[model samples]
Target: MSTFRTASRVDGNQSTIVASLRRIGCTVLLTHQLKNCFDILVGYRGRTHLMEIKDPAQPPSKRKLTPGEEEFRRTWQGSPYHVVETIDQAISIVTAP
Candidate 1:
């Protein structure tokens, strides 16, 4: 279990990306509220994926993960973390074998 000391913020494009993933039959849970963690947990093909949804419209610097997020991703031993800037990227990740 991950310990969250603060609430997380959702990127502007997160909902759109999530909707697309659900349309393609993936189960998406909004994990963005977990501080220093990935924004979404995706279930597909009996596997789970962790995605950090970065809004493409944001500037590069703003889209980058925070120090805490970086550390969490680096140390996490469960599913690998993915950073996605577009809905297509998120879809491809969850759909890929």
Candidate 2:
């Protein structure tokens, strides 16, 4: 994730996005154990939501998930996890009733 850290420099943006989401009445979860975990767990009106956020500058790359994260994702089978490139995409997921 250091590569991503260098490319996007999104720590500030991520925090802003989280605050914006919270301001607009969305429940946001911040997890320290999981990398790229902020805004990862969001439950919509009636739908289960799972999303991973990345910066556009950091071109697509695959990385192996730790066993715990993998298991958590697997356990939440009903909701489809989405890899999102922007905050709007996350908002869409939350507000798509």
Candidate 3:
């Protein structure tokens, strides 16, 4: 049998990010429960985006991606993937033309 470690599910920054996206006329879907998947699925202006939300307080060098996320990044050929460290960045990505 293999052991599994549950990923920390609480992200203090997600609420702000979701609010910011919605305020800018984007639809945001929280996918935090989907392990290794992007944290959000966003739609705007007839386009979709996959976003992995990261804590800005965490240094980039210390951030690590799960095996599933790695595979998704390497193999998926759908919407653009983004790593957003702040609400501003998330909003900018979804709103950018």
Candidate 4:
């Protein structure tokens, strides 16, 4: 099984993202921890993908990434792990994985 998670200050965008993912046949898991951990989790073709979503208008902070997120990036270098800036970007990440 796969779990998809995202964080949003407002429920509108969050709900929209989750609904979009489901439309693409993804199972979305709305969580607080997974919000910062990763944007989404995708299980397809026997593989699992972890995603991170960020507002494009919002630049990446110099602050350190989470240990799990950092480890995920290192171990799955070739996979599609991205920081999404907009709804389009979020959809792109979900579709990529």
By lDDT, the best candidate is: 1
Residue 2 deviation, candidate 4, in Å?
22
Name the lDDT of candidate 4: 0.55
Sorting all predicted structures by TM-score, with the top scorer first, yields 1, 3, 2, 4
Q: What is the lDDT of residue 12 in candidate 3?
A: 68
Number of the top-ranking candidate, with TM-score as the measure: 1
List, residue by residue over 7-75, the lDDT tens digit for candidate 2: 322333456656666776877675433543333566555566676555565534533443544665677
Instruction: State how far residue 90 of model 3 sits from its true place (Å).
Output: 0.9
TM-score for each prediction?
Answer: 0.90, 0.58, 0.83, 0.50
Angstrom error at residue 75, model 1: 0.2
Error of model 1, residue 84, in angstroms: 0.5
Candidate 3, residue 65: how far the Cα is off, in Å? 1.7
RMSD of each: 2.3, 6.2, 2.9, 6.2
Candidate 1 runs further than 4 Å off: 1-7
What residue runs in model 3 are displaced by over 4 Å at the alpha carbon?
A: 1-8
Q: lDDT, candidate 1, residue 55?
A: 84
Best-to-worst order by lDDT is 1, 3, 2, 4
- Poorest 10 consecutive residues of model 2 by lDDT? 3-12
Predicted candidate 4 versus true structure: per-residue lDDT over 20-59, tens digit per residue: 7678777766442543356566554455556555444443
Q: Is candidate 1 or candidate 4 better by lDDT?
A: 1
Q: Which parts of model 4 are misplaced by more than 4 Å? A: 1-13, 31-36, 44-47, 62-68, 76-79, 94-97
Report lDDT per candidate. 0.88, 0.57, 0.80, 0.55
